[model samples]
Target chain A: MSENKTVLYSYWRSSCSWRVRVALAYKKIKYEYKAIHLLKDGGQQKTEEYSKINPMKAIPTLEIDGHIIGQSLAILEYLEETHPENPLMPNGAYERAIARQMMQIIGSDIQPLQNLKILGLVGQYSGDEAKKAEWARTIITNGFNGLEKLLEKHSGKFCVGDSVSFADLCLPAQVYNANRFNVDMTPYPNITRVNQYLLTIPEFIEALPQNQPDAEPQC
Target chain B: MSENKTVLYSYWRSSCSWRVRVALAYKKIKYEYKAIHLLKDGGQQKTEEYSKINPMKAIPTLEIDGHIIGQSLAILEYLEETHPENPLMPNGAYERAIARQMMQIIGSDIQPLQNLKILGLVGQYSGDEAKKAEWARTIITNGFNGLEKLLEKHSGKFCVGDSVSFADLCLPAQVYNANRFNVDMTPYPNITRVNQYLLTIPEFIEALPQNQPDAEPQC
Candidate 1:
């Protein structure tokens, strides 16, 4: 399980993929980035080759120690556990749960609702771009509403207390997606403040979608 | 921080709530079950009082030690950590990650897509019962396809190993959901085998939605 031999199957715009990227950067773990272009050629992720690597047909599958793993949260937990040098979670059990609570709010609640396939399904059903965007906005707004309240109780410089935890790893990515969908951030002052602070962190900045090798230029 | 004094805000049919219910039973943690009727009066989860307990307006909110926590996975992690007597996660980093991988596959991938709000959105857009069911079946099939592959490599008596782990905690609830959506389980032999085995377990059987105090007989 050598860190140097790691290879990450990632796509630039994938918020889930962005999560593992940030964690790897924060831990200063070197790995090969195999860009799986999600939009090109009807999604490279859907290719038979990539499917063998990740049966879920999702982005951000990490390969380490001859073992391939999927699910961004699972991969993040693995990294945190195996490489405990720069911790991404808080120390205590209760505090760690709080961190995970925030992560799940974004990861499970918000991101899944606005995922590429889901949005596509929305568009297919409604045949309206506005409706699809509205769907994304509604889920994001609901999730952010809860996140704002959580941050009020748990934030200092990050999503949970003074340290940068797993919650912080998920926040910026989801917030970035929220902006992409034009979900108003002004309603979430605490979330906005923490996201603003997170953007200044070197690890967070390095893992931004724009900073990735496969980032497409905004037209 | 006493286990006996806990209160779980749950809904009978909610798969997420079922995850926690089974965990509580497995750990022998005595807790009060506060049924929040999700469908009654336009969802009690959306009520102002319930929102105070969980700002996300979601279920399986566990209250203990003056702290209210939402997100089923986080709650399960908390129970595993705070009460390590009946451990849900296996020992060691790699093994734990595998447990989490299975949990996330079901928790994030399958369950969220088939959640009540998502199906509601599908119905609202398409106005087709078949489309709604198809949407659910599609996601469940995709998730189960991956899960079956995972189980083949990582199953013994449960989803991860010989002993029940966090992965097992997530499986039965998700399998029950898959059954509810009419997803054919025959194709995934591994998932069916595990799900069948899980149904025989006391904890899983006790946490079945039909066994809950708030259970309503099928019309």
Candidate 2:
């Protein structure tokens, strides 16, 4: 029973956390969610208990039979491997590379610059909300421009060669993050199309930050 | 004969380029190196010819059998898949996840913040070399700290439960990058020890940036 059980420590609004949630749901793996608010008391992830589970003290830590795993991309690969039934990666080596490349574009190229801590730095140093927004927008637009060009050549029904690879799991959350800063998604038809398609998927739909149990309802 | 050839478009000093170089050598694959000087004349990677090969215009774009691949982690995985004779990843899915996580730490979490362009941003917007260095130090410290804790638990002969995964390829370049800014490696025993062991491996030793044909001769 312990071996079959999986648990994820996640924040309700974290894009990284959302990526894992989408992956788990896509794989149809049942797991327990332990919410750690990133804002309350200066982030509950800083707690001693959480540190023991993940020294980075970040969210979307997966526990499989008590073995802890951190990092959203790592967690997705783990889920894909553990549950190979509904394969996220394609059959060929090149295809897999294309899939992972798209994932990296968002995971590495875009997300880090706009992360909470980095944005905090922008706020403190720049002291201009518009400047911070522009800073965030610059990286997102740069990354997405590259992604759009690449997707222009390779995208089919999804990122990569048509199948719903792990890259698909990443698109919505990343698009959502960009939207938070008012990044004009209108420029990239490929990205907008993929995001719209991803929204229709049951797994991706349920993993939306707004759909979380801890979501703050809008007035 | 063309299909049998593997060519890597790389800059000798680029950390991302080094990742693919080490992987190619580790797999014992013979390939051609096309040097694209990243810093000369406003960057050779920005050229139209290179952009045709890689939309991202990044270092370490790999061409194998007429097919192209980009992104360090993606290329490494591609090499692992196409040439399974020399396995870099561990046997189990969970262990493989651990390896990917370490790569993500280096690739996603750490590298971007320290890139030439980001440092330029710091200098441009934040207004000082000192501030840029401080920003670089902060993220490097944060990433290394997170990785050190992770390595404490997971490392054996190498990061991610041993046997030279992609994590081994990632660590050296990052450690080297930090040292370029004078970040002390002595602070990390695990990282230091692993890097020492990796240096002993002929493949890694052979792929050092200083050894490449395009490496500038320093007086």
Candidate 3:
């Protein structure tokens, strides 16, 4: 696939978007990054034009090989299958299942609870900023607590084994969000260690929200 | 895998667990069903012994061949990989991604927002029964709206094509939940059509929450 043909609709700080960005970078697949700022202009993702691309109105929609794909996990699976050279999953079926288990723990179980829209609803329902923060922290901490236990058995250098898989792609983004909510990471040494190691990799570093082209200056 | 060796820790009403049951039945995999009541006895899933099996304390934890697996999606993928005869995914990579995209739409986006635990949080935050119901309705309606559009192009007797896939496993359970929360389904004709069609399948019908051995008598 040519570099120019792949376009990713993304936002710098969206964890789901970050997962796709890191996966693309890791696979060495060249793609155009079209930043759809999640917060600007009442959330660009919710606009009519963007909804045509992804009906879910979520960021990190990948337009690749003339097919538009939504959902970061779906995008990662597509990349892993189509671009098989640098595989993002383990070889064994059981091992691959374990890796996917880790991904779902973060993607389905953790991230969705603390997503921007969900947090907004929490704020709306609670009418307290501290309560919203607390809600985020509680979910993140619970997720991490489970993750830490899983990683104790699965971690080698990354989230599965010695190789970097999709689980590794998910780690940094989630840990980034965990820190944003001021969740204590001290209890999860394995996650912290894997996250630290992942950040050092060039692809991961390049995919960091701060390094993205459309990143706004942090407050 | 021997039926005696395979055990699934599940709850009759848990949508995530329901997804696994449909997948297992569809794949013709024999497994022992061990009910872990989520609401009874202060949530049996939170007990110390259950936690040892699944640290996350979530339902539909599958134990087969001495390996324990959590996450409905992961379990489905594992079943697909291990029991490839009755494949739950399409052949082409792109089509597979679309199937997964559909699954994630229900699994990550819709289900998580309306999950029992999240709804409990919403209730706590709102401190009003009406507001809690509204919160559930809003998220489910938003998700169904997106799903309706996607299904317009993707549905063919199922969420992906004219065959059962992981997406099909997710659809029935979600639509079931949508009904429980009283979300207006009139606007989503595609979902309603597909869901009505899915209910006719024997595997799906057998996997209904009310059909499970541990099903409680509804009030």
Candidate 4:
């Protein structure tokens, strides 16, 4: 597995994909970006070839040294383990658990409900964009507000105790995605502040959807 | 923080709450159970009193030695750390990653979409149990299938390489919840077998929702 090249099966606009992309860059791991256009070809994630790579047919499957890892949090941890020099978690066990808690809020609690695929399903099943949007807004607000309160206790320029842990790598893309759906963040002052600070960094700025190699707007 | 008693604020039927309950029992960590019924009186989780304890207004909030932890997966890791005697993760870095990866599939992937609160919302907005059931089945099947494949590579009597890690602690409750919703598990042979095996063990058996002190037949 060590001799093989690194490749990422990803979509430029996928928030989960973006999280993995930023983590790879943060750890300075060089890899090939194989863009799987999610919208085109009736969601390329469902294709046989792609499904072979990931049975779940989800974007952002990381192929490192031929060992494939799916799930963004798992991929991020794999990168951290294989490249421990740039740790995405804190030093102590308690601190690391706290960071994982923050990452969980965005990864499990918030992102899944607001994902493009789920939203598309809502469109098909209910034909109630207004209702779906309200659902999205309520959960996003609940998640962010919980995150905001938790951040109040531990955040110091970053989601954890100042250093850029996995939490920082996850939050911005999600907040960005939420705004696109008109889920306002002005009520979430801490999220807005942390996101603003993250945007100023070159790694995060470069990892934004508009700045990706296959980005649409070419930011 | 280590001196205070461990208190768990949980709902009887919540899969998220069950994840933490199983983890604590696995580690033999003593705790107080404070049940907050999610369905009673327009959801007890929405109360300002409970919200103060957890801004997410979610159940399974663990107050360990005065430190409050909300997310179930995070709380489980905290248990593993504080009581490392019965270690939940394997020793090797790669093995540990695989264990966490499995937990993420259940904790982050399957459990979130089919959570009781989300189903309540689906009932409220869509007013159709059949449609809500379909959505639950779709995501849970996708999650379990991904897990079954990963287990193909990672399993050895347990979710990881032989030991009952956090991943094992997470699975039974998930499969049970899926069964409650009538999602057939005959397709995933490995998962069904492992879940059946875990059921015989006393720790897991004690943590089963039907066996819990507060578990109502309706919950």
Candidate 5:
């Protein structure tokens, strides 16, 4: 496995890509970064060459040890299984299910409703920038509201428990997204507290969108 | 584990819930079903009592062995982990990643955008029932398009390979969703093939929404 090269196809600000970046850094797995600009030249991810490796034409596709895997949560599961050192999953099955449940709170509910393509469609459908922003804000705020309630029973130093799990991988990136959309974070103290603490971790810090090679100067 | 009593909080028409039903049937796990009608009395899932058990107020929340698991994909993973009798996951790590990848295509990308809440919002905003239908159709079509392409390299007798995996659990329910929105399935031959084959299986037939106790007579 050491002889195999790991290559990640990523975009700078894609939250899904950020999740994978954090996991790779946490597990101390070395991978070559291949930037796939989501908005450049009508989106490089949509090109035939990139689509060959990732049929979904989405970022954070990992080509590791000759297997090309799309979907960020799936990538997180793969990394946890392959590199158990500095484990991102909790010890037991129930705990691991909780981790997956928390991550899906963002992955399935929040982020999917506010991704670039969906936002673009919203803007196009409404023909109003304010409406688009409102759409994203509402989606994020609603999702975080539910997340805050769930975290009441599960929160410790991190999302599922004291130690960082794959659930933590989704938090900071989503908070960043919430900030981008001007979501009021005051209501979600649990998410805010966990996200703020996560931002200080080196793995998450290095994986921040602003630190990516393709990050814009303003970002 | 045999002493455990499993319970599922579900709505008959939820595509996500239907996925769990198929998996439970395939694995031969016995569970008590408690119906949570999504549209009756302004959606029972939104009630304060239900919210305590499932903060997100979404159906297909699995209560098994004293742990309450939310999120459909997480429930599927928990089922596969707990009931290894008839395995729903593949053998190798790469194959399992492929299984998760395929499910995420539907779970994260497709279904999230077209759920009852989103469609209700679309109908409310646009003030057009047809527009809401269009929204669901477009999302499902785009997702199925990508899924169809990915299935090109992965399909044998099932979504990931010859054997049934978690990926197969998502197919029939989604195909049902697509038809409800009147999506033309002719373009997705791979998906059409796999879905039709899956329909003939006994577990899937028994898990059909029409077979559920709470199924609407029209459905």
Candidate 6:
């Protein structure tokens, strides 16, 4: 049988979208990349068509093997289960669980707080751009501080081990967002050290926000 | 060997913790519930001791199989992987992906926006209790609206099918929180229907916030 036709709906600067991009790249899976700009036209993700594809109106929804899936973690899990050659999860259940814990530190805890909707809400409530940015910084800083501690215990050239895993895929995008928010990296030496190392790897680099097809230079 | 002492570090009202509680119950795995009051003693989760257990200082950190898992999703995954009895994940990769997708809609997108940390921040910004609650209402309503659409396509006595899966574990807690925020649930009938049915099941009912050992009646 022929290969499955794959399509990834993504937004360049979205940490969750960037996560799936890295997972796709790491697995060496080829797909048609469609940019769904989060901005422009009042946020394309909110469109009715996109909403049908992803009920949450979120990005990095993968259309593959005759079906679609939303949620970056779900997309990543699908990729791992479908393409097992370059497994991102560790071997044992305990090892994999800890890796997922590291991922959730970012996925569940950090990025969601800085998501566009909340930031907009916070900005409206604060009535100040600077205060909104501070809110993002605080969220990212708290998460990175905690993640740094976990990395100190788990790192071996990567978040979980020397071999790059799913947790590794989650890190660089978060570090990028952390940098965007000016979250001080000095407090997170291990996180900084690991993110720096991951940047040298092509699979991770290619999935970066700046490298996406619709990427624009940040002001 | 003897059953591993599974201690679940949880708080009564935390959505993430409640998710794990249901998963443990659905799997019929017995565990010691260690309540860490989120608001007591300067937020017990922030203590140095607790930070060592979960750097993110988040609840539903399951201590099992001689290791600790810091995220509810991770804990749920570990339970599924280890026990494999009355499995919480559906069979088939595509089916499983959507199940996880449903879980993430609540786990990653919905509840995180209404978390205590973000709520406190919003409260600080708004300088009023009513506005903070309003902010939560907006977030939950938006998420439940999206989730309700998804439920229309996937629901069959449980999220993703007739069987109780990981996604089912995330819903009741979220609906409980939605009720707490007075989020108008009339718009999402499917979610309301599924939640009502889930509450009838003992596993879900037993894990409800009001049923928890530390539950306190609302004014």
Q: Provide the TM-score for each candidate, comma-separated.
A: 0.96, 0.96, 0.97, 0.94, 0.97, 0.96
Q: In candidate 2, what are the lDDT values of residues A2-97, reduced to their tens digit?
A: 666788888878989998888788778888888899989898988988888777778879988556788999988887777888787888878888
For candidate 2, the TM-score of chain A alone relative to the native chain A: 0.94
Q: Model 2 chain B, poorest ten-residue lDDT window?
A: B121-130
What CA root-mean-square deviation does each model show from the true structure?
A: 1.8, 1.8, 1.7, 2.1, 1.9, 2.0
lDDT of 2 by residue, B1-219 (tens): 266678888888888989888899878988998999988979999999888888777878888866788888889888888889878888978778888888888898899888987888777777666788777888888889889887888899799776889889998888888887778776688988888889889889888999898999853
Please state how well chain A of candidate 1 matches the true chain A, as a TM-score.
0.96
Model 6 Cα lDDT, one tens digit per residue, A135-204: 9898898888888888899898989878777788888888887777887888888998999999999988
Scored against the true structure, residue B128 in model 1 reaches a CA lDDT of 80
Q: Candidates' lDDT values, in order?
A: 0.87, 0.84, 0.89, 0.81, 0.88, 0.86
Candidate 4 local lDDT, A102-133, one digit each (tens):
89999899998778767766666666876678
Share of native interface contacts recovered by each model: 0.77, 0.70, 0.79, 0.62, 0.63, 0.84
TM-score of chain B of each: 0.95, 0.95, 0.96, 0.93, 0.96, 0.94
Model 5, residue A102: what's the lDDT? 87
Clashing pairs in 5: none
Q: Tens digits of per-residue lDDT for model 3 on A111-216?
A: 9988889888888898876788899988989888888899999899999889888899999989988888888888999999999999999999999999999998
Ranked candidates, highest lDDT first = 3, 5, 1, 6, 2, 4
DockQ of every predicted complex: 0.78, 0.74, 0.83, 0.64, 0.73, 0.82
The TM-score, computed over Cα atoms with residue i paired to residue i, of candidate 5 is: 0.97
Cα lDDT tens digits, model 6, B1-219, are: 124798888888888888888888878878888899999888999899988888888787888877888889988888898889878888989889988998888888888888888888888887876787888888888788778887899888988778888889999888888888888888999888888889899988889888888888866
Candidate 2 runs further than 4 Å off: A1-3, A127-129
Error in Å for residue B32 of model 6? 1.6
User: Where's the lowest-lDDT run of ten residues in candidate 2 chain A?
Assistant: A122-131
Please list all clashing residue pairs in model 2, or write none if there are none.
none
Q: In model 1, what is the error at residue A189, expressed in angstroms?
A: 0.6
